[model samples]
Target: MTRSPGAGLHLHLDPLGGAAGDMFVAAMLDAFPELEPRVMADVIAILPPEAGQAELSRGQSGGLAVRRFALLPNRRGEEAKPRGHQHEHDHGHGHGHHHHATTYHALRTRIETAPLSQGTAAAAAAILHHIALAEAHVHDMPLDEVHFHELADWDALMDVTAAGSICAALEGATWSLTPLPLGGGLVRTAHGALPVPTPATARILQGYEWHDDGIGGERVTPTGAAILAHVTGGTAGTRRGGRLRAVGMGAGTRDLDDRPNILRVTAFAASSGAGADRIVQLACDLDDMTGEEIAAAADALRAHPGVADLVLVSLLGKKGRPATRMELMVYPAAEAAVAAAIFDLTSSLGLRRTELDRLILPRSATISVEGIRVKRADRPSGATAKAESDDLVHAPTLRARRQLAHRTETG
Candidate 1:
């Protein structure tokens, strides 16, 4: 059977040693080797012929086989040198640039204008933007003034872009991550010896959960942090339930005696029927607020990134007061934030909260048709498509809007 695009896909990251850009790409490619050629081609297409080359090699970590990705940058007429994950300068600011440094703006422009798929370019640009934000925060400088130091070479670019390509390939996949291991130690950089998880890396992973494992080294590099930040959206948490589909191990440069330096990535598939999951539901009734105030509150709740879905309904309250009852559904991880948002946005003094089991049917992602994005779902009857009503906000007439939606869904 031909699988629909983005159907029932889930990805979980287990950063055993730590995460780096190279390891992220390698692990993803290892799991989906079929994507390797296309990823490499995209990377090469964006980069100049003389810039360098990217390759994947088989290696072993603790006697277990793994795949490693490296960027070999061409130096003059000499053969390209492979800058592996062990090189601190790959993400550190300590090294003096042997070549002209590229600004964050330039890098973003390069990636954005590169000959790559729309999804890959957008993903790669977002990842670079995350890194730029971290760097700007660390240096206390304007984003434009921040020049590429550690990532000046093609090494960081390849790692990040490859990671972006992998993410693009896995679009519609639910991404989750394990708590990262906080390795303790001093790392040498342009600013001299600094604590492990370098300044930029720390900033990039500000909200992420980390636990010290007594393993001392650069666990998560800045590039890795940016990639994770992009994936988790700063809401790093444990994996959800799903059926395992594939697994891949990506090895780093250094192999420790106590543990292997490898990252494990696992892909999962949503089951054939509705999947059972737990979610939090909060409800509140308000009779004292004006319609405008209630509408504003509901809008705020709906706009919150943590909120899954929200509904408002008319109801009769005490004294036969006309009131609006607001109900919000959110995942357990986001319940606290959503609850706080409710209190901040509404005039309600109290809320009714409940943990509910919800069954979700597997659905495909929204795809653009005739420049209109349409969502699709699989049903026993067949497949169905629904055009987003928001896309018709500018329509001249209701009949025209209906006609456009019908064409988008049917075509």
Candidate 2:
């Protein structure tokens, strides 16, 4: 049987050892091994000129083997050496980088210049933006003034970018995350000692549920928190239920006594009775369009054969300019056509699209008053029936149609 467009993909994350950029990326790769070439290539292609190659391998934690990611940069210690050589760095920093620390501004520029797909680049920048914001606030400095320092290293950068690329790889899947584990005791930071979860990590993880598992050490790092904050939109899932499609275990560098330092990623398929379906929203900011122009565009789109619906909202776009954001939804099969139509109808050269799971009422049908035999859907007091609205041209009156519908329902 054919399925409707609403049947979409859902992703659930189990950050057992708390989420970090590498763990998140590694876990996702573990879940979808086929993505290694495509995902990793983009990371390598877009990295700063100074970065080396990225290496993903299997590692064990708490006796469980999991996917571990590291950056094997081109530069080396005194001499260029083979990959997998352990270098000096802190816990938050992944693998090792021989490059100098970059400022938040320079990092942002580097990401923008990278030749990445639309989705991957935006996601990468967004994850970094969270880190930058948190760091700026923690130091009470301007955003541009904030130096990435530990966060700017190749491993951290790769982790951050890989996290974004992972999200891009899971393009059509809705993302949901479990609450992070807040490890007990103090954690060492570049500045000094701080409570577990680290202040910057805590700041970026606002709105997410957290609980310390009574273990001693730092579970969530700023890089991890920033990735979660950006990827999950700062919201953690209370519960997600569906048929499992895939699962990946990402191993953290260190080992834990009780729990495996692994992040588990699971994919779920869309199901019925929950009123949930897969959805993709395409939006573009229209700063130059007049009210009439916007309305005309909407009218044209609403009439498109593939478009499901559209909404024009007033908002502030780049540089505080007044803009109208035109958001539209369509069936998965219609996505490409709809995007092409938007380009022809508006001034937007590019549009943003996000795949999501949307809950809709459990019902079915069609309606057409002009048809010789129209089809309409009606649920009266828990009972469902296909109703035919009044047709003065064909039917005698409204009451007569209801009587006919009642007889059909009773039968």
Candidate 3:
């Protein structure tokens, strides 16, 4: 079914609840059965032969029927080796696995050439590109030289690509999420055993609020964390006013006793009557301009490129000096241009900028004549009218002039 105009989607990342890319995708499939065939095929195609043994199926959790993607160890070939099971090997100064560096350029090309939907493929490539750029910056390597290990694996590729596909499918809608649940503990990887919520995952979760449930396991994967970071723009909070329609639960490979190991995806229809809001506010103080200059500056600012709306307010500053405070509502993208105008036009040494949410309404003009008000929804083309009451009152009438002339002649 097509989503209505004002709809939005809310996704809650339950890290303590086992956050894996496969788990999330399985849950999404269970929630939207129509997408199962496509998503399943895409996911399985990307998995290596050994990893493909794991089966994804529908199941129940917390009385809710959800998709469970269980990772079953392969019994043949290299899979014969214990998969995901910890083994003690004390030959060195600590427990760590050898991490192989996977070139970013190679990964990018592979993702771009993958057989997937256009939107999904693009998103997947974008996420990889972002990761590569970040990694390059951190390691002081060229973007092309940066290498990813676990992040470039088949499972990770599937997860990142699948998440991107899902997001692409839900475009044109706002996505809000709850504070991510980042479970605590050490995680085993090819690079050795690292603390749970790996370094990559931690870096992605920066600037966003997260809570630790002390589960001591690798609940959140780098792929899953990257997906959440890319989708929500790093903002987290509960949303209101949107009608909740469908809820999907994605179950992770491991089961938790304290809570359901699932990610929740809630589809919502935003309130149609709700108005649009602003994203930023730009304000500056100018205590050094004359009245005429201030007026001219206000006009110039209004005409300034990128200034949405300008308002000048008179106020008292320090030492009782009168001043004009200029407030400009600017598009977040245009803050720079508007600020430059303020600096050039007036002697104000500083300007304050803030982000705000404001609502606007539609309006029309009206005019009044002879005590009667007339509403004008639109401007009339080339139409003008003028009225003078005193001139009309003093003018002589034709009938009075004729009577006076006859009376005077007869006398």
Candidate 4:
């Protein structure tokens, strides 16, 4: 689908309620129709040995016809080992040490060399790196040297690569996510029994907002955390003004009583005239400053180069004393400059700053300079000219600089 220049895209991640890689890949496929076959091949190739014989099938669940890749652990001529003794006594387990690094590296190589877009490859690499880094930190080893026992499993490799491919396909879109659900309970892994949302998962969830649903089991895995962390910018909340286009649900391996074990992802298209908009909100209150100084400070703040919007209000403070409230909205990258300007131009001791999501219209502006018209070009509607000045004033836009170079070449 062709999107306008300022279109907004929304992506939602259902962490605690979904399957690991399967849910992620399914959601992406729902958004991009062309990713199905490539993802299926990756999934089939990476089926972990522990999963036994893996097969892909189509089925309907929750009124949606979807692809279900089911993996059955090899059971022929083998009996289930006792829970506690399985690790040490089972001869079929093969290697004493898990070759996680070798498996992950091989999978990564396959993904990197796959017939995929550049964006897809880079995104897949990033997800793998996140998983590897978490494992490395947990084992107290360098990221490149540490092995990923669980994540390196074939299933994980397929899921992550498919996800990367989907993300790469949507190159120019922005992703917004909802709050993640972190299910409650304990989970068993190679590292022994640990609380649900293990240390690695916790690290990934550190700055994000999440709620615990009292369900027992591993709701979110390291692979799931890695994928969410790589895509969702570690922030969660609602977005307004975007129209929901498509939604996909991916089911988990196990069933739960409270809710269906599934992940839901939704895609959105921004309303017309909506462009990329971000605002930095700055606020400070002071009771000591005189009215004159307060007015001066407000004027200076408005004059600052980076300040886009500014506000000042008077309010009653503690003990019925009057205080001035100063607030400013500016571009995200210009936050530091706005803050510096406030400090230099005001008498408040400290300021509070926050980043806000905003929608802006597409815009362009022009400036005039005194220079010779070295080059001229005629468009279907209007004529454009490029000029050069011997004295350097300010660096021109890249387009302007390119035009100047073209003029020089022709001359």
Candidate 5:
């Protein structure tokens, strides 16, 4: 296994209730509790010029007090806070740089110019890309025209950028999450009223486990989904006898009589033994399926959060019957849901599955080259950087920047 200073730190996310951006950052703070000042400082230093000042608060969620941050934007000389995912995000902010709806490219440019760590920038860009791609599909518009909408606010940006910095602050610590709960019911948005787990949220969280908790209003926000996508390394399943370090509980503003309506996270000491990391691979054969059905099946497979890779092959089966084989490489926690999807969507009754071990480097870093943010993975051999496709479009000279990225990747 690749070693590092924070090698033994592991996090278990119990998002069974629901998830949100503020909830995640708050829960993490609940773990460190004392790191609130430092994390907020880093976030403030990088707050966008168009955004306003942020104020933090300590409050109770289900009787457990937590640290939460709120953005105070000067709207007509009147400060405003988010109201249950309700914000007046018009194309015209009537002040500063937000004169019109910020397009994907423009925001990409803004992120490129911001003074932030490479990993922080790249993580933010990647999360935005996830939302952009999904929004493009949901709105059936060109990716370039798809503006940030409700996602363009200062709070949303802070939510994403803050998440990036916090993950980096953890050093080599690894992040894993449990199945997510899709809060059921209707919710308002920039694009009119939509279902809970909004189209973009559903799109970004295609492959994760979700269920209705019978709560009205949105439980999971796009920022929350983006945070999970930005930091989480899919499903890490259950930790076997790892030491519990800290438990953080973040409560949502809405009070539900049935439950506490909180998001709790458990911090654990990373396993120091063999078989610490393993993934599940499932394979099934398909013969009696239509082309349209096959296409939809492939889309469903690709959207799942736990799947690492998926492959489809055509071949001749018994009695020379033409058939196709579906091979899926998914995280161990996704086996059941993936199998259920396969059976429900295709003509498959049984599946072949196997678990394999993997060694992961403890460190996560980012490097910016020519104003382009790239996610860096450190290996013993060296480091490799990956630019988010959504924001990489801003890079004018990819060839030269790629070389610079490589050279700068060296610590």
Candidate 6:
């Protein structure tokens, strides 16, 4: 098929009810149905015949049509573990099967050895690694020592693999999600009743925004949290203006009191002018701090994650006072964290925030011409390349620096 205009492209997830591994798979597959056959084939190639068969079926949630994904067990005894829920229950009745507790090493090995495309396997492994890291953090143990009780099950593995494979297939597209819904109340687990957002899920969502829905339940599972962490990197997505290409709705297992438990994935056609995205502009004026303190503050802001750029300008403030004016370009998602960092690192009483639409050209960096790194930006007219100023720091003189930069650019 010709993929109906905008398929397998930039993805923005709306976790209307909540998110899970199956929900992620369903949403992606729903948006791009052309990928179902290959996704399932790849998933089956990795697991044994008796494990289960992957299925993508049409369903409805609160009268809303939706697509659902699940793994059905072939044998009679090994019923498919319920899909789209947290696996925290302790299967102590099995005596030795810690719900098939699989170590981080074992899970990594499985993904590595699976018969999946290189991109798919690597992406899948990275997503799963996010969960492992969360678990390690929550348990206060090293990454190598972390083991999953339910996340290691065949269903979870398949879900992660399916999500990864789909992501790989949708190459070159950026992924983003809305602020995750934070459900209230306690949940039962191996360690007894824990709060709504489990420890692992909480750890995975450290820097991301949260939307409290007041309703109580496990809204974001560890698998879902890991997928979001891998996709957005704890940053908000840019605002892009373009035609909405396609929409797919995936249903969650639970029935919520307020809204239909469905997650929506929307894909957009690539926009023009290289690229256009949104950034938060933060500006503050400080006359009390000395140059050293202002410089320190700028350094801290620059080092913060999601802060794209920072500038410090000497300007005249109120009453002809000489002050340092600080302006920072930060990702919208990281605005809160960056604002907190600014307050902690500077003596500024207040700062100004403005959301700006930024037009940026496609760019990449390459090292060449005496190992000097050059950043090349693609423009409508032509491509332009510039050598990194820091790379020329070792030049003995200004002329030498210019010569090196010219050589790097020309070559």
Off by over 4 Å in 1: 1-4, 73-100, 272-274, 280-354, 360-411
- Tens-digit per-residue lDDT, 1-411, candidate 4: 233222245565555354466666755665555667665555454444454554455565554455454343467732222223221101101122332444446556666666664455666766776666676676777655655556434445556666766655553344545556666666655667667677767765565556667765666667677777666534333343367877776666565665656677777775444455667899998788898898888887776645667888889988989998998987565578678878887877798988887755422111111112222222223333344454123547767766654543232
lDDT of 2: 0.66
- Which portions of model 3 miss their true places by more than 4 Å? 1-18, 44-54, 60-64, 70-101, 272-411
TM-score of each: 0.71, 0.61, 0.60, 0.60, 0.71, 0.76
lDDT string, candidate 3, 247-356, tens digits: 77877655566777678777655434333556456776777778998888888877653566788888998899988888888756557867888788888888787888
Clashing pairs in 1: 94-190
Candidate 2: where are CA atoms >4 Å away? Answer: 1-7, 48-50, 73-90, 93-98, 272-411
The digit string of per-residue lDDT tens for model 6 on 74-156 reads: 76776555444333221110112333447888887887787886457766876877788788888899887887754645777
**lDDT string, candidate 2, 124-206, tens digits:** 77678777778889899998898775564566777777776776555334456766787777655456666766667878886
Per-residue CA lDDT of model 1 for 1-411, tens digit only, reads: 233344576678999978988888889988999999879988897767776788799989988889998866665763333333335423344254534347887887788778886477767876887777778888899987777665666767878788878776765455678878888778766567889888889888875668888877788888888888776655553355787888999888877678878889888887765667788899999998899998888888876756768999998998998989999987687788788888888888999999998876555333232335565565444456788788778779999999989876654
Model 5 misplacement above 4 A: 1-7, 33-38, 48-52, 73-101, 233-241, 271-333, 340-411
TM-score of candidate 4 to 2 decimals:
0.60
Model 2, clash count?
A: 3
| lDDT per model vs. reference | 0.74, 0.66, 0.56, 0.57, 0.63, 0.73
How many clashes show up in model 1?
A: 1
Show pairs that collide, candidate 2: 6-278, 52-73, 52-74
Give me the overall lDDT of model 6.
0.73
Per-residue lDDT over 343-408 for candidate 5, one digit per residue giving the tens place of the 0 to 100 score: 887888899988877665443333332334444454555434465454455547988556555544
Check candidate 3 and list the clashing pairs: 6-270, 96-192, 97-191, 97-192, 184-216, 185-196, 185-216, 186-196
**Model 5 per-residue lDDT at 308:** 69
Query: In model 6, which residue pairs have backbone atoms overlapping below 3 Å?
Result: none
Candidate with the greatest TM-score versus the true structure: 6
Give the CA lDDT, 0 to 100, for residue 208 in model 2: 60
Write down the lDDT that model 3 would get: 0.56
- RMSD, one per candidate, in order: 6.1, 19.4, 21.1, 12.5, 6.0, 7.7
